[model samples]
Target: GLSLEPILLALCEWGQHHADELNEMDRLADCIIRPRQARQPAIA
Candidate 1:
């Protein structure tokens, strides 16, 4: 429906505006996750 189109577009624009903030959060999350992933012994 047309109603959802505006809402979806607004949400997409908002995400674009906050792209850097989102990427920073992703980097922080990866820092937390990567160490745990690295700790596991390799399955050679």
Candidate 2:
């Protein structure tokens, strides 16, 4: 699972320097974390 704390902190820092680009990067990060699926193995 992705940790939102560090991401949010980094985004805040980036936003201070590059607000527009940070917005786009935030969108991309959202997409990247959405489709992850966990796997389980069957026992015989």
Candidate 3:
């Protein structure tokens, strides 16, 4: 209950602190994935 609140809050704060880095990672992942997705032909 209350015990987990502090840990969750801390985790949220940590995530916020690394938001930029996380966003960059997300962008890089998308960049890598998109080309691979595009290269694959869709089945009819």
Error of 1 at 16 (Å): 0.2
lDDT of 1 by residue, 1-44 (tens): 44466676676666655766667545331211111223668799
Highest-scoring model, TM-score? 3
Compute the lDDT for candidate 3: 0.51
**Candidate 2, residue 19: lDDT:** 45
lDDT of each: 0.51, 0.56, 0.51
Which sections of candidate 3 miss by over 4 Å?
21-44
How much is the lDDT of residue 26 in candidate 1?
A: 50
Provide backbone clash counts, one per model: 0, 0, 0
lDDT tens readout by residue for model 2, 1-44: 54575686677666555746555655443312243466778789
Name the best candidate (by lDDT).
2
| lDDT by residue (tens digit), candidate 3, 1-44 | 55566676676666655766667535332211111223568799
Ranking by lDDT: 2, 3, 1
Residue 21 error for model 3, in Å? 4.2
Candidate 1: worst 10 consecutive residues by lDDT? 28-37
